[model samples]
Target: MKRSHIPPLLDRKWLAPLLITSSLSLLLFLSFSLINAKFPPPASGFSGGGSSSELPRLPRLAYLITGTKDDGARVKRLLQAVYHPRNYYLIHLDLEAPEGERLELARYVKSEGVVREFGNVMVIGDADLVTAQGPTMIASTLHAIAVLLKRAKDWDWFINLSASDYPLVPQDDLLHIFSYLPRDLNFLEHSGDLGYKEVERARPIIIDPGLYHLKKSGVFYAKERRSLPASFKLFMGSAWVVLTKPFLEFCVWGWDNLPRTLLMYYTNFLSSPEGYFHTVVCNHKDYQNTTINHDLRYSRWDNPPKQHPITLTMEHLDDMVRSGAPFARKFEKDDPVLNRIDKELLMRLDGRFTPGAWCMGSSRAGKDPCLVSGSPIVVKPTLSSRRLEKLIANLLDPETFRGKQCK
Candidate 1:
């Protein structure tokens, strides 16, 4: 309609070429901007053009540290040992803990200088009822996983621990070694053989009071027992595990109905925590091949295995180290071995966090190196990393990794 008002420039032969050039220029600029936004420059210290081998992006771990009545102190201690600026933590004190203790734990988390600065640690405002032998325990773990999935965005792995569990190496060592690993792999000790568990655990129908009652009480066994599930094969292993975000997302989101279905089936199964995840992971084709079949925890059991693992003491230190496990459990409060581990392995002071590259402050005059924060992506692996590397190597060995799955 404006043809009558066309200027001499529009009539020129160069006008068409100029318009095409301008359109292409605008489109190219937008395309470049999107590419830049999608992949920003690496952190300051990192090198290379996107290969993880040249400069791996440090991995972050999300820990669910749970406790009961008299476990606040131990939970706090465990927090200090595993705390890092780059990672996220969720602390849960069960309903058994008094209100004062819960408040104290929340206050402690809020008061810590580094925690306040990074804003990474969280104490659940409401506690979950957890009965270890019943489905409620598994429910609590899933609840924590769901919360972590919603609250945090960058964690690579999710590890569940109790107040009694302690790390054998500093967070830096684990982070450094894990940076090289594939993010999809999951570390858990699982087997398809249910032998004795089939009778003692799977067949027993029990109801956990924690699931419904406000006050915690023992689970009651029902007169009727259910048969083994026909839809899915049962698997059993250690309750402790190191899992992945994608797998846990599958567990929590339930886009595929398998997780929800199995969860309902295990609601009456005794010791559901040991089998729920194991069964779900093994039955799914996408996740089955990703299993590492190692819990990465050190524990000593009696000859025939008792109700619980033996409490660790100084005598088990060498064995714990030699096993190349990253964590161990069932330590009494204020165990001497904890002090030894703090001093020798973690290089941590009594109240300070485990020392790592991020801790740039002075430690020369008994000051906490973690007082000052540095680049979070930098990792300084120590001798402990060598043991972990070996452990990973053996577990991932072609013959070993494939043979240990589902079966």
Candidate 2:
């Protein structure tokens, strides 16, 4: 009586409806269970989506693209040219810029859907003061590196650049080549002599007033000059570099005193960007073998030499492409040669970012194809990247690499 008219659910043999209901219920239960199994976006960036989800993944780069007052636009352009979802970036606008420009730069970077989703792009909330030819130039760069280290440890290398600098290759071109290189390798151009620069840059004991006072100002030379460093030999070269993350960590945290000592030496040294990294790499035994000796950039110094590099124009286009450099610098804004580079070399058109294999959008009528993004990890190396590869291969030759160290 207690079981009156109870449906014999398990007893029904060929009961399609009953079996269907049971199977459907089971399926629903399993479906709901599967929904609960998802982990949050991931504590670490690695995932299981596909090739993208598998493995530890190659690595990321932390970039410090710094500039002064009116350079926000150039900084933005540089960010676009070098943007890769896999990389981390920190754009810093120095105290020289109006607060409004810095705010706009931050807003633009954060607002870009790609950047916001990746969560790898950062703009310095607090800006620093850097005076002309002052140690503050080096300080500003260090500050950005510290911020990057604190923000993300996923990076492999640290590249320092200014807005005046523009990429000659896509980020993928650089990253693909870099992925194969030893993690300890640092791309820096150095010279042991320092040339006539010895008297002007090395011996001067200049104080960067901007180091203390908030307002931007030029370096103020003290009455006295300092002698050449005895503890470490001074090696000077190009200011821009692609530095290994380990070296940067060593430089910034500086567990050893070599970096700290060099910091003091360059405190009064002119053009510290050129000397700081050069000295750090050559003096550090652990990293001395990692130097590439070439800056990976195409720069044309004036025939007679000037305070700045010669501005590249159409005349330099063929030379720039053939140089096998990943970047070139000091172009006049919106120069025609840049457009030519976009068309002939980069396959990019207009002022938009140089589209790479990662760009999947349409390119009809002078549009930005990178607006539509695709696989962030896919790298389609160009003849240009291959050319660069050859150059790098030659530079890393046993005969070449060892012989060129700190020479």
Candidate 3:
């Protein structure tokens, strides 16, 4: 092809300037792109090219749901109640449960078409023996966390629950509200008030046989007691937690020795689950400010409380809702209250997943809308979200948030 004609005088001066300007602009753009890629904006605020009112990316929750013998059905029920395509779930039936129970759970997980499609749920084949009040519980939780961190790289928070626990709100409500929150916030009930725990828990030395044994057994206390730690203050609270991914990584990877040190220390501590994460988060300067002293679970303890909270019943239904807690514990297997929750709060029916924005199918004649899946990021929150929002607001308030930290 013949070259197009150009004015010689115009070409000589303008072409060189134009080329230089364009080349300079390209170099500047690439440099800025590299910088942006290397060090993106902080997760707290909006990055470039988005409206200020636009919400942040939705969070993915990693759940560790544990149970014992005869809890396989309950575990499946709990999983259905909280199922969301965006989140990851690891079902762990401890070694106390029979191998058949574990296999049944695995088979059920495999059978669910939606769960199979999403590939977010797993059953632990090699289960851990988790003594309720022992360090083995903590070990099981941490193991689940490690598995989640390895398998699902994008989950934002880790939550531990038992088959006895159930959600008070839909997963959409939780995910929607959490989309507006800072990813670093760790929701753990913590207090340094050693009160009776000093005598009952901290000073006691116990051995968890579950750690070294194939069969489950209670933790036995030594005849002699030990003095409290001078190196770190003891903090204790509810074992149930909603922890940030970064904090869990710190615990699992143990870049700093504090987590490992506390792990070893808590190995012999009674009810270690209640104190291990609390003490670790409180003692670490990086995580202390991130603590939001609440486990986001509602339970009715008896007068002078017992080992476990009272089994939640229909009588506690009104209180459970009003508490604005996302979860409640110690419900009896197949309780009527759970059915009520399914009918009311969750709008879930028998043998169906809780309906959410991601569920695209029709819902006439008591059908599951979640039969057809949609984008997981599409969060259409319900009125239940307002309750969670209120709870979170109160927790984040100056009087409760900072004032209650590590205290």
Candidate 4:
């Protein structure tokens, strides 16, 4: 008697109301999701932090661009090629260059509207005779580094380039890829195997006149030979280098005696620039493992090699692009290849800085985009960054990294 047929509630009337209720709930959920997508929460870091995902802070580079007599114009050109507001540049024209030329370069830096606005570029007033084959080159390089450290406080890496060196990619492209790298890594191409240097360099005792003389001169070989260093192993390679600020500071300040001792040892050594930093970094326990063993520079050598690398030209363009290095060296002044690099790779105007995301000014005809500057942290990387990323990945491979370090 109690089982009266409560009609089954699976009726069309009930179905319509149930579907409408479900649809409203779905719409409300979608609206809420879209609103959060449009305006995400603020990042936990300081103002203008890159992303909330903990992306690494962009690193700044300290550049030492050195030149000799007749290099004034080339140095100026190289400055524009690699100029970035976030980085610091210390340009040196060794004592060999005339005062007029150095003044001209200073005038050029002062006259550039962008350079003046950022105030990141400087020219060394007092110079020394940097003999290419003597220890004086090393002294000049160290002087430039000390100047950079004193003038700028926030740079992370120090790069040494000559007037002959040229950039293979845009500064933005290079900096964007470097942002992901470890700050402690030092890029120096070095080796324990001395090869011909064992007989030619290690055993020789030479005296560099430029070290003591105001006038430019060459190093002379002495009558007696000397023994190889017993304390620290010798390493030598390309004179060009990209080093970390901490490592350079360690070198310049010499809180540790190794840097000073090595400096004294290399004083009489021929071509000390090739071996000073290499030996110092390799011998030290802390910096030995940080060596990347790659200079990240593209250079050409003749068969059996000569004292100097062959000048790069258009013929080397394809190989250079494939090498994925950030810079290439031994380019002749005003070479045709440099023009092509400016036009294609760096997107630089004839007399202007290479344009990047920080350049907020108009790019109208005959006008420079970098004339009006923007935030220094903003970077617009190009496809070349992918190439640099690949190069870094190969360098950092676990199987290969340890094997290449300090060996």
TM-scores, one per candidate: 0.87, 0.83, 0.87, 0.87
Give one digit per residue, the lDDT tens place, for model 4 in 65-167.
Answer: 8999999999989999999887888888888899899889888877777677777887777776788788888877887777666667878899999999999
Compared with the true structure, what per-residue lDDT tens digits does model 2 show for residues 154-238?
Answer: 6788887788777777666676666556666788989898788788888988888887899987787788877887878999888
Clashing pairs in 4: none
Report lDDT (CA) for all predictions. 0.78, 0.71, 0.79, 0.78
Cα lDDT of model 1 by residue, 1-407, tens digit: 00111111111111100101111111111011111122222232342223566555678799989999999999999999998877888888888899778778888876887777777887876777788788888888888787777668768899999999999988877887776677788889998888788889989899888888888888899999888878889999999999988788778767677888888888888889898889988998788877889999999999867657999999999998988889998899999999999998888889889988878898888888888987666666677777877787777766666789899
Clashes in model 2: which pairs?
47-53
Off by more than 4 A, model 3? 1-53
Predicted structure with the largest lDDT when compared to the true one: 3
With candidate 4 superimposed using the best TM-score fit, by how many Å does residue 211's alpha carbon deviate from the native? 1.1
1-407: candidate 3 lDDT, tens digit per residue = 11112110111111100101111111111011111122222232222112345445778898988999999999989999999887888888888899899888888777887777777887777777788888888887877777777667888899999999999999988887777677788899889997878899999899999889988888899999999889998899999999988788778777677887898899999999999999999997787877888999999888876779999999999999998999999899999999999999999898889888778898888667888886666666777778887788777765556689888
Model 1 ranges with Cα > 4 A deviation: 1-53
Q: Ranking under lDDT, best-scoring first?
A: 3, 1, 4, 2
